[model samples]
Target: MELNRTTCYIASLRSSSVSRGYRRIIKGFTAYADVCFREFGNHVKFWTTINEANVFTIGGYNDGTSPPGRCSNCSSGNSSTETYIVGHNLLLAHASVSRLYQQKYKDKQGGSVGFSLYAFEFIPQTSSSKDDEIAIQRAKDFFYSWILGPLTFGDYPDEMKRAVGSRLPIFSKEESEQVKGSSDFIGIMHYFPALVENIKLKPSLSRNTDFYSDMGVSLTYLGNFSGFGYDVFPWAMESVLEYIKQTYGNPPVYILENGTPMKPDLELQQKDTRRIEYLQAYIGAVLKAVRNGSDTRGYFV
Candidate 1:
């Protein structure tokens, strides 16, 4: 992928049990990055593993609609384990590639390496207080901290131990150190938000409603959602920027994605005005954060 003066490209190369597959994938990716960078100079500067490692489970395994058709709860004939293994392998592979790129090009042109990943925002359901809070935290842990923990802090979240018990794999201190803080950029793609709630501690199934919605909340929590008022609030985006800044040490962030969807068929209403207002409000919030010293570079709608 050339043009726009890019020197390299990075997709998702997760780290998990599928080391062999991950290795092969990264081999191809690295070859492409090298070809593009050597041939283009300052055009492209990095490469990625795959894109959005979490989808391997969150959107694929737990949701029956996607390819591979892995069931939720992950008990779809062991498909859950398969998805987790693949996701883990991809992350490790990605880290490996970043390490290799850093080593091979250290004396060449001082170029950098990194990957782009989608990040999800989770909020606890209004009810079920303590349990809901834990649920939201768990969702965040599985959704964001899964990658961030291993990449930034060098370990999996503690909750994983409780969820999968001894089934969760362990990483050696050496391996942890190897991947810790390996990437030059942590690209974040975000849209909408998720409301989480605790359930009866059963393995998830293919068609089960999201824990949040199943707990009696509406399904708008799922994708491109913007209703139930607050359309003019920019605080949501602000909170996200602040969270990333604090958790990841303000590493250079790019708002890889941000946008709202308004159905074209709907008759115009006051909320329509609110939607435009929301955009201005949120953008202002982002600008304020940047002015106050956030590292956000750009946004994509």
Candidate 2:
């Protein structure tokens, strides 16, 4: 079971009562995880240490839209650097907790530990343009690899290192050893796909850049920016599963969150035909991915 919602770091960073740096945060979070493991490990066979690590770092540090509200122009926080710093600390913290579980509790408890990331199926805005196609991959590198790369391969993606330069955190030999192969499974929280359009790097790079600016791509959602409406696109789910299978050695995956939000209409909420159809289509897509050997193990909404 997933214990933390937006991750311990995000919550702690948001809390006005708590003010700590990355190292302190990691130490505190690892201790907290130890307590949870000691208390819940016997009954819970599957544990997710953090939820949406990528989104938390991005929304909180990069955009300053979430808790702590720190950005380049905000009252505090460095959008360009803090995101990577927090992300690096999270990877190390998650690895430490997973190692604790494996060494101390796995055999006795018969439980597994995993990490979760916010995932989006990105489609190129212009299918014919080679740059657009490449931008789609760059976006993935910035978004998915920002977290998954360290967990899977012990370092951030080469593309990310090149793009973010010194802003991206570095992993030492020991930290890399601890971070790699840290998870038994990966949890994905996907909603809808985003159309990725290639952008010129010179303009964004000439000025101060955040995560999206580093990726050199713009994400356009099909519907409103507000969370009130959604358009079901099951193909995006299938594509994301397939991409993960091909890119990440087909690790076990759990669909931790997938759903649509509707407005506060009592009659429509009672009926909810659209939501039902959305679920059915997405489940079908998951089945299709499994049939194609995606190694998807669980689904949650």
Most accurate candidate by lDDT: 2
For residues 1-301, write the lDDT of model 2, one tens digit per residue.
Answer: 5333222333454422222244776677778888877887766777887788888778777788877677787788777888888778878888988888888888888877889998899988989989999999998998888888888889999999998898887899999999999989999999989999998866644657788888889999765647686788889999999998998889999998998777788887679787778889999999999999999999999
lDDT of each: 0.59, 0.82
Q: List clash counts for every candidate, in order.
A: 37, 0
The stretch of ten residues in a row with the least summed lDDT in candidate 2 is 2-11
For model 1, the superposed segments whose C-alpha errors exceed 4 Å read 1-33, 39-41, 71-77, 106-110, 202-233, 262-279
Please give, for residues 1-301, the per-residue lDDT of candidate 1 as tens digits.
Answer: 5332131333223323242234465456557555655665354444444556666444554453454444545445243354455555556666776776677664675656655666655677666588777666676666677677788887877776455444455667887887688767666666656666666534464234442222222223554334544233456577777777887788777665566666664554634775667667767888988987889876655
Residue runs of model 2 more than 4 Å from their true location after superposition? 1-10, 14-21, 203-205, 224-227, 264-270
Candidate 2 local Cα displacement, residue 186, angstroms: 0.4
RMSD of each: 5.7, 2.9
* lDDT measured at residue 76 in model 2 versus the true structure, 0 to 100: 81
